[model samples]
Target: MVDGALFAGPALRRLRRREGLSQSAMAARLAISPSYLNLIERNQRPVSARVIVQVADQFDFDPRLLREDETIGGVDGLARRLSDERFADLAIDRDELNEFLAAAPHAAAAFARLYDNAAPAALRDDPIIAVRREIERWRNHFADLDTAAEALADELRLSRGDTGAALTERLRERHQIAVRILPNDVLPDTLRRLDLHARQLQLNEMLDPASRTFQVAIQIAALEFRSAIANLAAAPQFADPSARGLFERHLTAYVAAALVMPYGRFLRACEGTGYDLAVLGRRFGVGFEQLAHRLTTLQRVGQRGLPFFMARIDRAGQVSKRYAGASGAAWLDGDASCPLWLAHRAFERTGELCVHPVLVDGAGGAPAHWLTMARTVNGRGGARFVVALGVEAHMAADIAAARGISLRAEDATRIGQGCARCHVPNCVQRSLPPHGAVLQFPALEQGVTPFRFGG
Candidate 1:
């Protein structure tokens, strides 16, 4: 059984809501204080083994059943949706996912079912399928695009103080378009939209200043660099028309990031600050994610930054989006990353950078040692996400992240590939035995390990 320390508050909340029982009623049935029960349900306190047994006995079912059936299915279903090809590169957290599950279980179940079976073979073969494939293939680096964007950045003379003004002036002078921030009701679901006939760029007033600035830069790029984007998208590598179109759109976002942080200046700051994202974000007036995204694109010919791999995962350990700085690195495309990774730990303490020197097994030909930095960020509608960035140990030493730490083998944390492929023996955190490895569970004795595998 999972320990109470890893208390699942969301599951407890769902269970209570499902049974139509008040907090007091449930506490009385479980023979616990209502205040303590409230804490457990709210995830402030983990439900102890005693409480679990009491709940099982009171509810007249196995305690394990409560956990197994609670919200695992919903989370798994949502993970599948997030991993879909269309959302391969987007950081999407459904705002209604939890609310819908609580208010209408049947509807939520139906939605999950529909989403699970939503994509057919034809849909998977969409024209833009290659765009996502190329991103993964290139490890998220676009040397040509980076060069082009750098040139544009230098031309625009972009800076934090004047990016908004520059883009606004360009929109009006070059495209004869106007920028307007509309109320939430006017542009409820979108951050920004362009109306060609009205010659106006509409932005939602709900967005923060940084986000609004990004939207404006993207619009300006779309208007000014249409030919450049189209030419890059029509490369021989792109097989489908939709792929070309999507690539074009991604190029605009890349352009926006490049404009915000010009390549030469950003690289200088990065080197000076030892790749500190917070410092870079503040200097560039961008968000953490934007800074990280820009970091991945810093492969400009002879002038390159550290080789970094970045990933965005939800609280439930689903990897929504991932990108590598160079070849030979492994990214957990669909499976849950190792639970022991500091990235997951950051969820407990959000907005703080937790550093770990990890030895990654089965990472292709990449260096075994890596210095990783993990932090959690809150998204729209109470959605929390963890972002992790890492560089090989050799490259990490010069960076400030490696300071105040011993880099010896003994000091490093030994992490395996995910459970399915991991071969580590006697690990308390092992979720599943390694595939094809026989397990010998002696009845007479049990070690701290749940299972022992035969060599």
Candidate 2:
């Protein structure tokens, strides 16, 4: 479904079992032979489009579920968990892992959970990391919320009018809540606040028009989609209350963006415009950062746009926001990205789109090439942050900014995940020695790199 053969046997089997149907019974319902169904369930054959349509029609479920199940805490995650040094002695191969995942998905999920529980205290207990992992688990796409927001957008007629004005009018007419733009001095510490007793939604006067619309949409989401947000936040993975709260806020924001852009219209506009950020910003009445963030969420099945990864980094190289979407860029998981990445240089040419093509050395795998676009975005209270959006190099052809950009291996900048994890030789910008490498020093001479390490 995503420009590839869909091999989702485990998901298909799970669905059939959830529906309380035997293989023969489900096969009869799907108008397929039992042997063929078995083959599909075993992942020996890809799930055909006809079969996906039949499943959707008969089960009354989103066809995306099959694909989602395939990735969510599935083989890739299990493989990553198994790659840890603690499990290095086991030497599990890919085919065996695949067979194990297919044969016992619940067991595989339990193992993943076990692996998470076994992680170091810093990673296991951090609420922010927990929420991020949860978000990545779903690839930042919430189908139900998107559907609900799309319906709400249609009902509010958001696409036909000024978005901010439409949301403001809706709040006043339906909810009887007046929206007030208070002086920055009055709301110095907050961008938005809702006073229930006063029946007012207050915003800081410093917010731009696009941000004001987004804040209003958030209020609407909090009021209208409370149940959906709560349901998503209620997932068992969020053991910590802080994680649940953070996830709930994130879901509200996602719904707000969906309400503003509406999935179908946004995807069409993205594809039509070749993903030109400026043009899409003008059309959607959103800012560049918002557009980039929304770009990471267009993972609807059979209608996916490019699998973009987005990050927001400050001048000090601290990453504040990261969504790994399908790009799976290793830098997102690190505390700091490579200095050579365009994101770090975005502040030098503020407000201008800086594009770069780079090859990232992943963990013990082939280097993955990416095309990254970065620009500085004005943050709250005069602060500025660089927002970078990236997609795999192969998928960059459809992007307007990537036009005439060379992604050839020889032309690309080679970067590591981070200084501590990178093993790239002779990198002058590396601030720390690569992890798991022995440092070597030549007493007689000094090279450009401060630290030399054996690979």
Candidate 3:
């Protein structure tokens, strides 16, 4: 193969199959010989830019599809799935995995799916995990929900008047549901509840204006977009009733967020403000966490915002909410975030933005640099949680928060996903040795960390 040439055999073959075209037919459409097309399909010859453009123009498809890394079920995703201790005996290397993926991408994806289905009952039946996995699978962007919300927003003229008042009036006029705010003593345990008998939606008086608006929007979602949300939740993967219920609730919240912040308007504000979280929050009348969460869902096809990853962690370092967006790093898959991450430190300086650039140790691939911004937000009942947003370091120039910050690797803090999966040696804050490492303890000498392990 020529040096630095593009090889996209799997993608080309998939496109051909999708188009239901024979190799000769596709070659004829592209004005190329069948023999040369065959070589390209087999990855023996590099796909030229001219051919790429011709394929795009002929098929009316995005040219970026051909440039995507067709690493089969995602290199990191498959690698993490194989890292399970059950596959320890196989001892698969990176090269072998790559070869297998390249040889049979569909089979590789099937194997990953099978592995997921074969998980232990405890992990498989966890409704929360299932819901989170489903969210990540869709990259937290639901076009149907976004479109519905945008239409509703336009009908309600949400951009012109007070959003909450407009939504409340809509409920009264359209659904005959009166919005009522009751004292905490009246509804001690519920934030929002719908009474079908009286056609009333009750909210706790303690909820702030933003929270009240969000709860109202959620009611709208439950009433208006029930079929859409139900259809999304009906996927076979959510066989568990609990999982389905959780997913439906998540979708409801997603729609509510979209209603509150219409996609086109919000995305324009995001770009205009250089993605300033505080400014966006104020403009949209949302809290810090809501602003961060909405930022991850701006993945409309042609007008995509920066691919940002968002997470919410409590004081105990437990991640309650996480969206990987386009930066689907394996670290975002689990709750074991590194102690050194700014999310943990945001607790010390509540309500203050903490910005840091860090090098995240990839599981078995090249390291990734990120520009992470974290701040504490007050949740319901006075509970405080840290919400962190991060984007790839290369995108720092476009972010307002990353201004005046150096993105050099040497100047960044080195952190890992967590101690159990991280192989960064001698980390002073490591709580456990990394997987597959040989632990060593010498009585005569003391290391920075409690456990010394061989790579």
Best candidate according to lDDT: 2
Clashes of each: 2, 0, 0
Error of 1 at 44 (Å): 62
Candidate 1: give the clashing pairs: 127-243, 128-243
lDDT of 3 at 433: 81
Task: Tell me the tens digit of each residue's lDDT in model 2 across 1-455.
Answer: 22556777888888899999999999999999999999999878888989999999999979877754344444545555664434433557655666786566667777777877878988888899888878887778998999999999999899899999999998999899999999989999999999889999999999999999999999999998998789889964566799999999999999999999999999999999999999999999999988988999988877888889899999888889998765655456767788888778889897899999998765554567889999999987789999999998888876899889997877989988678867788998989987677799989999899999775
RMSD of 1: 24.0
* Candidate 1 ranges beyond 4 A from true positions: 1-130, 236-246, 363-367
Q: Which residue pairs collide, candidate 2?
A: none
lDDT of 3 at 421: 70
What's the alpha carbon RMSD for model 3?
Answer: 5.2
Clash list (residue pairs), candidate 3: none
Instruction: Name the weakest run of 10 consecutive residues (lDDT summed) in model 3.
Output: 67-76
- Positional deviation of 179 in candidate 1, in angstroms? 1.9
Whole-structure CA lDDT of model 1: 0.69
Candidates sorted by TM-score, descending order?
Answer: 2, 3, 1
Backbone clashes, candidate 1: 2
Better of 2 and 3 by lDDT: 2
Model 2 stretches astray by more than 4 angstroms: 1-31, 47-111, 443-445
How would you order the candidates by lDDT, starting with the best?
A: 2, 3, 1
Q: Estimate each model's TM-score.
A: 0.67, 0.86, 0.84
